[model samples]
Target: MLIDFLEFMISASNDSYIFLAGISAVIGAILPLSTIIFANFYEKSTVQTNDLYWELKREVNNSKAFIEGFNKIIYLGDNREIFNSTLKLFKLISYILILLWVLVGVGYIANVSKKPLDSFIISCSTLALISLLIYLPRILSRFQRELPIKVENKSCSINEIYNIFDVKGKGEDKLFYEEILVPTLSIVNTNSKLFIRYNQNLPLNNYKVFYSIQNKNKERLFINIGLLIKNKDFKNIHYTIGNEVSNTDTVQNKFSSIPFGIISKFNEIDSKNSFIYILDSLNQILYTGEVKCIFNSETKISKYTIKTYIDKSPNGHISKLLQNNEKEVHLLDDQQKLTPYYLLDYN
Candidate 1:
């Protein structure tokens, strides 16, 4: 009986087979097209606010609204269990319809001709369609990933300096100094080797040294100096900070030898002022030395330095020198040996 039915299908008229295949193809095409249209509508209905903070707050406050709206669009107000069941049923129906379409298309092609050219064309078309279906999601995801992120334009100014550094007033009455910790994490961008030297032995309590700030996870937060210092702050303190090694001949990479330093403050009082050590890299530090304020009466400039060896440990921790007279002398000798190291000098 099955063989007789197969024989009847093979001997059937091309017109009848073509009509059946066309109808099946149209119905199969419409189901997926309607699915796409409904999927787009579902996407539009679930559009989220651009601000992540506000969007999360809104969701937390009115979580049910999202669920209800999503259900109304995707499942026609049905619960998740019912929606899932219906989805499985629809998928099964789609698969069945696709199988039927392929079977009908093959039957129509067979009825029309027994030629190799016709079979080759049908096979190529089916393979191409399958390939398109397989890769369509990946292509769409790639398109979304390549979209540019929107960022608000921030105008650069000197006031931004206050935002970068933690400023505090120290002292009382007639004389006072502003103690600031300019976070080296944000400002150090150059590949240059930064050296902080204590030109004179003043006091360790007065000056700020290069330090690292880590989060709860113990990860360092990195920031671009170019973005932070694109204003008057760069111009005002550019001379005080050196980004070049003195002896350029010994340095193979000239750009990498550019010295970098941070200016602590600009003040009229010579005795009260101090310089903060800005490192070339966030990980680098002044291992051992005391920073001192040496006010040049003639030059009217305050010079601050940490006469020390800058070294990194295996565990990513900076080694600190024992604060004593002997270590201080050793640090001075080390600084003298390190000829091309930069200093923090300000007028």
Candidate 2:
């Protein structure tokens, strides 16, 4: 009886091993095929993303060219419509592509070969979700575009102003005037060497400052003042100013000092308000301030400007200030004021 029981146990063990081997063989075959399918889907999604990206780029270049040609401002409205539409589509597609790849990774971890029917259902559901996401944004963007948007040319008053100067001669015969926009109203003496410390809370590192001068005739001149970058330690910020002649042109006279008046006409704009427009690389205005000349006995010695701009636009803080508007918008609570210190005193 003991010999018969042992023989029965051995047969059961052999049957179990055979069943396990069959399962493994099925899994091994299914996994490779599933992997190939996922890989193909990933490759297609990547190709679609690349194609959309290039299309978006082409649209941007066309819009830029239209603006540079000084075409009617109405054409700009049309370009914006196209740009927003393309951008929304591009974003949605990119997000769905990422999600699809993540789903493929999850399938491998979840042992999807064991449940082929469930895996197929999941893939179909993912594709449906991607389609829905891509379609919804288009429908919404179109609806929004068709709706009339009343954009008010709102003007805001400056909460604080800072007077910064670099004086060489006594009072009137100063050759150059440099204006530095700080968050705080700290008095900087040109005679003494001081380290200008920016407020850490101020979003200067993300923006590029442009010195804009408009003459009495309303002709505007824009200068790329400088951009503030974080130091290696990320504790302090440094200013890097350069003048770009054109898209393909480069100048050798890259100086650290903010060139207030490279053109003599820039100094002659005493009758009009000189504006310091803070913008990102995309030409979106983040802040706007007026540069007022301080005349001492009919000699323009110093200049001062307000430190903030209107935060009305959706993409940026401010768009533009209405000319001669009495309505005043207050400064945002989150805006930080800058403080300047002596360079030797900085730790």
Candidate 3:
């Protein structure tokens, strides 16, 4: 009876030991198995992220390059109509391609044969990525890249610009001398020769006279020109403050007041031409050997005088010119000479 009990106890102990060993082995395997699964998830996620980044970057660059190239064609070739048509074609194609990509990616993700939870995760992620893919091109169209996309234009040739800068008139008449004030301060023709200056006591060579004008055909923003002497040129200019304003009504807070008239240095041009000018808002003809001229540009202030020849006046009277309250008005006698006193200011 004792021997039977001992055998039974030994068998029970052995079974218990086996059960404990099996439980310990399963516990040990649980951690490694979980670790392996997590590692695989991380690897897959990393790959997806990398691919997404690269793909987005590539698409962005390609879109910008395409647009930039198209603009170059318009600018350099003067083929703006053709450029717009071609670019519109590409824009349509890209739009169609993006729509198709979204449809496929979304449809596959929604109905694919996979675990419901996994499908949900992948669907959300891919939808986000694909949605970005769909909108990325549109957004990238607005995005300016760091890389400079230079497009040269079919601009007015240097020769043409130079010739215009020479200030030709109805004939090849000489138009300048010492000092000239802006009539209205409008830059009508950038292609033509223009100069704006405040003839202060600065070295002629060192002082940079800043001015700007727009292209008549293009109507671009005001582009600045550097200091030009009797023979100089400017290009690749930037925006800066000046003594004058732009072609538009937006006034420059600095140096707002423009001179009422202009005085020229050339005597020969004055005697020969029937040109009239302003001095302190006074309309005076080029009657003297010292040419007194009125400067004219597109930019107009509140009240001002224009520079041109008016054949009606036998002698352009300085006193008749009254641009604004800023100037004292002078009148003319029946004899067409300067009145003894200014008409408006004597009182």
Candidate 4:
């Protein structure tokens, strides 16, 4: 089709307008495809980053849940490796393709234009240079994030959170459950004196804390702050738990211009405590359940977050998920632990 178009364009060869038309046609075809490919590149980066972030987040959260089980989670390093590899692929392929695009733009201009060979070379060279200038940063932009920290055989365990909620289980069930808990969650407010609202039952006496921001008239926002929990006997685990995973279903902020989608519960903390999520979006333990942190590597700072997949209720053939994989956990850690919560802290 490109060739036919090019031929038709060349047939209409009027030195005055042929070059311009050819440039337009070539750009018309290539731009759309390039846009789509670039979008895929962005998507690949996001998906890959989320995989890594959640894995680490889960591992750290689980270890903190129970002090004793931290040792068990260190080995589940599977998804960490997978995400690293996927990210590498995304970077390598993206840069090369972008460079190829510049090359093609230069080549197309040279082929279709009837200018003197010297003039064509000069014009194409300039165009290629411009194209390179535009895409080189694109190739470089993704490199800004440092690669994930290696699981350096050191970790913190909150065995308390793991024991608090039964967050791990079989196969895709666990992963799927986590899908709801985890989100493309990001901190929206960079500067705001904020605090985490806990469900009162959270018993942590020492740890860092933060929470998302809510305004009566704006879209919900996430904010992360660090606070130390030094009072271990504070028995309001329910409030703390609820605070950690509660979907924002309170005072509707009608003062803003942005839309808050479905109560805006995309943010999830990668901890062992099963959050009391009322996926009112679904309604049905299949209705609401806790996010139990199962296991995280005790020996590594790198995470292996896993969850105890649940079916809550008879939502359909959800029960058959366990029978689907090597019998459980589609994505895994280095030690072969399945996702939903980090693995090995299973006390």
Best model per lDDT: 2
TM-score, every prediction:
0.27, 0.24, 0.21, 0.21
Clash list (residue pairs), candidate 2: 183-338, 184-338, 195-343
lDDT rank, highest first?
A: 2, 4, 1, 3
The reply for model 3, stretches above 4 Å from the true place, is 1-76, 80-85, 88-96, 99-102, 105-256, 264-347
lDDT assessment of candidate 2? 0.35
Model 4: per-residue Cα lDDT over 1-347, one tens digit each? 99976664434323523454465457546644554455455455545644644454555445333222222232222233344454455446545544544445445555555567755675666566456545644654453343232222222222323332444232332332244223111112112211122222222322322222222332222222121333233222211001121134232321112212212232333433322222211111222233322212342111112233434442222222222221111122234333221101011
**Per-residue lDDT tens digits of candidate 3, residues 247-277?**
4534333224322221111111222332223
In order, candidate lDDTs are 0.32, 0.35, 0.30, 0.33
For candidate 1, write residues 1-347 as lDDT tens digits.
99987775555466755675577478557755554555454333333212332332344324454333222322321122232343454466546544544555566667665789887887677556545544543332221211011111211232222222233222120011112211221122223333222221111121223322222222321111221222112312221224334444343443343323221121121211112223222223222222344445554444443322222331322223211111111111112232222333334
Model 3 residue 269 lDDT score? 22
Clashing residue pairs for model 3: 164-193, 165-193, 184-299, 185-299, 186-298, 186-299, 319-330
| Clash number by candidate, in order | 9, 3, 7, 79
If both were scored by TM-score, which would come out higher, candidate 1 or candidate 2?
Answer: 1
